[model samples]
Target: MRRSREGYEIYPVADAIGGISPTAHDNAMQRMIQAGAQPVNAISLVAELQRDWGRARADELRSILRWYFPKLQEIRAQN
Candidate 1:
């Protein structure tokens, strides 16, 4: 059981896990690798990469955004 800042009772974010599964490593890596594949997803991915992973990763994220931004602009120009 937990209480919030105002002292109201609150449910936990999730129940405690007995133990982490070994495959969790591979699953997390796969999610990271595939996150840049979509437009909306790329936005968050760039933010996360910049804030947490620093300049090198941020530059890579910028390149990904630049690659996709032109396509989006073309789509906007069509309408």
Candidate 2:
């Protein structure tokens, strides 16, 4: 497995979104979609959206994070 600078193991984040149990994956997708439905015209809103998804899917959160990173990154870059 690849390792991050902080020494965390780095399996492909995308893998989490793909092969997870279907019920978990679908739940994550729905949360991600909801998080993404908000206006991203401001950084606070983007942060809130990210936090919302992270909290909503805390048990298996990375799937949503994987699905929405690009959009979230774009919003973060604006801050």
Per-residue lDDT over 1-79 for candidate 1, one digit per residue giving the tens place of the 0 to 100 score = 3344576553211112122664774464445335432222445545654786455556676677788889778989998
lDDT to native, each model: 0.51, 0.51
Residue-wise C-alpha lDDT for candidate 2, range 15-79, written one tens digit per residue: 23443587886666555445442222333444455676547555465555566778777988999
State how far residue 24 of model 1 sits from its true place (Å): 33
| Over 4 Å off, model 2 | 1-16, 37-79
| Distance from true location, Cα of 44 in model 2, Å | 29
Taking all chains together, the TM-score of candidate 1 against the true structure is 0.34
Clashing pairs in 2: none
